[model samples]
Structures are given as structure tokens and as C-alpha cells.
Target: MLKRFPFFLMLLVGLAVASCKDDEDKPPVTPAPDTVSFVATISGSQQVPLNASTATGAFTGTYDRTSKTLTYNVTFSGLTPTSGHIHLGGPGRTGGFKVPFNSLTSPITGSQVLDQQTADSLLAGRTYVNLHTTAFSGGEIRGNIQQGTTAPVPPVEFAALLTGGQQVPANGSRAGGALVAAYYPATRLLTYNVTFSGLTPTSGHIHLGGPGRTGGFKVPFNSLTSPITGSQVLDQQTADSLLAGRTYVNLHTAAFPGGEIRGNIRERRLGITLGASINSAQQVQPNASAATGTFTGTYDRTTSLLTYSVTYTGLTPMAGHIHLGGPGRTGGFKVPFNSLTSPITGSQVLDQQTADSLLTDRTYVNLHTTTFPGGEIRGDIKVK
Candidate 1:
């Protein structure tokens, strides 16, 4: 019986070992998914006012429930989106859109830690993608949240000026031509207007070459014998090449089959205009009115320069200046106004820092007075 007992004990031990070995040889057990991904097709069905039905789009994204993070990517055709958001709603149902996308670039690939409300909505599948544009303030395209996957989009935005002088190394092309091309980052749409003189080219093309080096053609056009104007939807690689500043417009002439007038492509002349109306409501003392003014400004992004066209009246202006401030709040001095007195009307050049501050659209124009040393009337500069 003792020997039998010993054999029984050994048998039990062997069984236990065999069980553990079986577990080791088995495939790994996968943990439950901690992230959710989805894709949405955008079309007129989700559009507001029944318009912009022509617009089509796609949105793909992933939300990590554990980390409370949301990453998204979007692509759209038929319209440009000025603002985008993930709104709280349901399929076939519409709701308020408040969750904003900040620092947005092309393809809408940005990350935002989901707030409690947004996270809840996402889990419940009550969140959707919304895009707003100039024509459609409500929404141009939208899609309900679903489960899927989407890769991120490459960021590319470009503009280029066509000129004989901007040619590679030296623009020896006595044949003159000018072209302005603007490429939409998200959709890869290329729209251009070209006019040329001094040479009749059989064709024109945007070649894969830079300031000093010349390479093969990337996009070709019909004979530019006449003024060339139209649009072209580019592929991904071609768009990337254009945005890298490795592209140029070279007119093909019978005289020079290789190329004739060539101008390097780059971001075209860029500028922004800002202005705001003055009212007592915008002042520290809302009642201190009758002292109104207007702030007009234009900024050249390339030069980092600003030109101000300011005019004010209805106050004994002690001084006029551009102050860095927000809505209903005041900030420190940014740039001094030329004329310290009232009826200040003139143009002033803003330094780089001052120009940058205005670009934020947060600054205001302050007119000081002896009676009201703080400020008489203020107008917040609004980019136009």
C-alpha cells in the first residue's frame, strides 16, 4: 500500500507538469482591445440644408479608451473645409458641434485628449465627424461614428509665382511668362493661371527640378500657345514633389525643345488683411463711447511686415497705439500709433514681433485720452 501511495503521488505530479507544459506550448492569449478605430463616408446625406450634396468626403480615426486620446484623419472633395470637428450625435441624427480641432492642417490628422463628455459620446457611438466651409457654415460633409481603420494623411500645402526672373540660377529666357499656381493640401487639387509674352511655346510643364538643378517633367499641359488656365488633380507623389519646392514651370518652345523660359516654383506672394470696428462695448468702460475708430491692417507673410491704415475720431486722443489684448480684456503695449492725437489717420509699419502678435487676431487698437488715461475707445483687430 505504501508503494502504491508513492506511485499515486508521482502520477499526480506528472499530470501537473504535463498541464503546465501544454499551456506553454499553446498560442498566446490576446487581451481585450484597448483602442477603437472607425471610418465614415461623407456625402450629401449628412449635409445640412440639403445643399452641398455634391461634396463627398471620408474620415477615419482611432480612439484609445485607456489613454483617453483621439486621433483622426479626413479627406474631402468638392469643397474646402475651413473648420472641422467631432460632434456629439448619432447616425441619421444631428447634434451640436463643440469639440474643436486645434492647430488643424491638411487631412485633419491631429490628436486631442478626449474630455470626459467627448469620451462618453465616443464610447456610446454618439459622436460624428463634421466639416464646415465658407459656403456651408452648418456643415459641408459629415459621417456617423463607426468601427473601422484609417492611416494618416501626408501634409502638403503650396503656392507658387511664375516669373521670368525667378528662374533657376539665372532667368536668361528673354521669352517672358508668368504663372500662379495654388495647390489644395487636403484634396491635391491644382489650379493655375498662366499668361506669357515674348515667346510662343508649344507646351508647358511643371518639372521636377529646383533652383539650380533641372530634372524630368512631373505634370504636362497642352500647348501654352494661348493663355493657360485650368485645374489638375495631382497624385500623391506629384503633390509631394510640388510642395517640397522642387518644382518649376518651363515653357517648351520650338526654338528650345529642351525648355525655354523657366521659373522656379515657390510659395506665391502671401498676405493677410485684418480690421475691426470700434464701439463703446469693446472698451474697458463700455459706456465711454462716442470715441469710435477703425483699425485696418494688411500683413505680408513673406516679408513679415505690416501696413496699418487706421482712422479714429470722437475723442481728444492723447495717443494711439496697437495693444496686445483679447476680447473684453486689455493687454500691454505692442506698437505705438504714429499720431498721438485724435483723428489719427495714417499708415504705420509694424516690426516683426508686432506683426506676429497681430497675426494672432487677439490685439486691439487703443486710443488714449487725457481724461481717460487708460483708453478712450478700442477696436479689436479682426483678420479680414
Candidate 2:
């Protein structure tokens, strides 16, 4: 029995050795690539930190090569950040930009793609991230972005600017004071800059009405005077009226209870002659190719209709639509392409908010092709 046991043990050992030899002869198992993570901490001392204040902040980034998307998860303390960026450079080093933020409002998160050069710089541990605010146009808080493991923070892009102006009193008080208004489409915050030389206005309100017409007040100001600035968070209804071109700012005084000065609100326009440079660099999906296009558009706020004519070169058109986004950020679909002929003519019945986006340069026109599964040529539809 002992002799038999020894023989069995030796047989088992031989079998194990044969199995190991087979494994060596066969191809080795390959591991899948991991999702790369990066982090940054910004302070006044960091080279190239905007240093808007003695403030500080942090950033987290993840890169997914399958989708070729880079997403940022960010947080900041002791600072108010309006925008952010991923710039190329080593610690205490100054370099160019790699990726720009899609949005930087509170609860900051943004996603974007980078060109090959920028992507290489980032993966090689040669980049930094930063946050920007009104006070700090360059940047506020910044941190060196390095590859390391940290808890995951998911992010998406915030981003818009809409502007219009009203001259006091279409027919009433020729009183001085012009109201320049800017609407942030992303936050729905409306700001007004008022300047006047003559007139003692008791109060002022943005009312819903037309030139020579009167309606209920929509947004009321805290006070009125020369070189005054105020901001209001807009409601849906008020935004609706404003986009319809039926709203105006009126300065009310004891001298003119109805309104001393009034000016109508209107939308701006960007001519169709927009020469758009189309290339893979601008595509949501990264590639390397070039295309050309143009966008001509006219919008009427009262009717809420946007008419457009688009032209393209270097590809056959498969499909097209209007997208709500800017240069570096990809946004949701808003409208579709209609005209099939040269100088394709299409019209969109937009909502008040959509109208505001068109006027504020928040909307874009895009054309897709079979060759290029993604967009071939796109132009930001702006009010120039």
C-alpha cells in the first residue's frame, strides 16, 4: 500500500508539471485597461494659480477611453467659482490649457473631450485644474492634477449669456437712464445695469407690455438711480413674457405714477453669414478631419419662431438638427433640420426660454452625414 501511495503521488506531481508547461506555452491573459483618475488642490502658492483670493479648492477627474470622454468632479471652499479648466504643466509650472470646464456653478461637475496632445499631457502627470469667478478672470483656486486613487465624484457640464437694452420711456418721460439687461440662461438670473443723468425715480419694475402698451409688473427692483445694478431670479411666466418682446423696464416716480421712462425689450440676431470652421476637433466624438459650414438665422420673439438657412461643404448630408451648446461643451437637442435643398430653410416654434437661448448665443446648428456618424459641420447660432 505504501509503494502504491508513492506511485500515485508522483503521478499527481507529473500531471501538475505538465499543466504548468501547457500554461506557459499558451498566450498569457491580458488585463483590461483601467479608468484613469486625477486630482488637484489649488492654493495661492501653487504656480499659475489665479489667486483671486486667498481661497482654496479641489478637483477630481476621470477619463474613459472607450467613450473618449473626460469628466470632472469638483468642489471648492472659501471661493465662489463661475468656471474651471484643466491646464497642462508640472507643479509650479506654467503651461497652456488642456480642457475647459463645461459649467462651474455650485455643485460643480463638467465633462468634455481633449485633443490627442492635451490628452497625452494629462495622462503623463503634467497638468493642473482651476476654478474661475467674476473677481478672478484668470482663476481663483488651483491644484496640481496627478494620477491617484480617490473616491469617485461624477460630473456633467453648466454654462449662457443673453443681453438686451431698453431706453427709458418709449413715449413717456424722456427722463435719462438706460437699462442694459443680461440674462444667464444656465441659472435663469437676470441682471440689469441702469445709468441715468436726469430723473428722481422712486422705484422701478420690469413690466410685461409692448411699446405704448401697459401690463402687470413682472420683476421689481429694490431701488433705482444712476449707476445702479440689480439682479433677479426669473420665474417661468416672467421669462415667457420677456422673450415674447412684450416686456419693458419702467421707472415709476411720484412725478409720473404710470411711468416716467420706459423701454421695450427685444431679441438680438446673428446673420446667416456665419463662417463656421468644422473639424473633428469640434466633434463630440474625437477624430481628425475638416469640414465647413454656414448658418443664417432670423428670430421673431413675438411669434416665437426661428427661421434659419444653413449651407455645408465637404460631405453629403444625412441628417441635421439644432443643438443647445457652445464651442467646447455638448448640449441637448433643441430643433431639427428641415430644408432639403440648397440654403435649407427651416423654422422652429421655440418657447420663451428657447427664444432667449437663441438671442443669447446658447443654441447651435449642426449637420450630420453617413460618413461621419457624428456631426460633420456645426455652427453656434448666435446673435452677432
How far residue 181's Cα lies from its native spot in candidate 1, in Å, is: 15
What is the clash count for each candidate, in the order shown? Answer: 2, 7
**Candidate 2 local lDDT, 232-317, one digit each (tens):** 77898887677666787777778777676665665432222223434455666655556676777676544667777777667677
Look at candidate 2 and give me any clashing residue pairs.
41-143, 42-142, 103-158, 168-262, 169-261, 169-262, 272-296
**TM-score, each model?**
0.32, 0.32
Which is the leading candidate under lDDT?
Answer: 1
**lDDT (0-100) at residue 348 of candidate 1?**
55
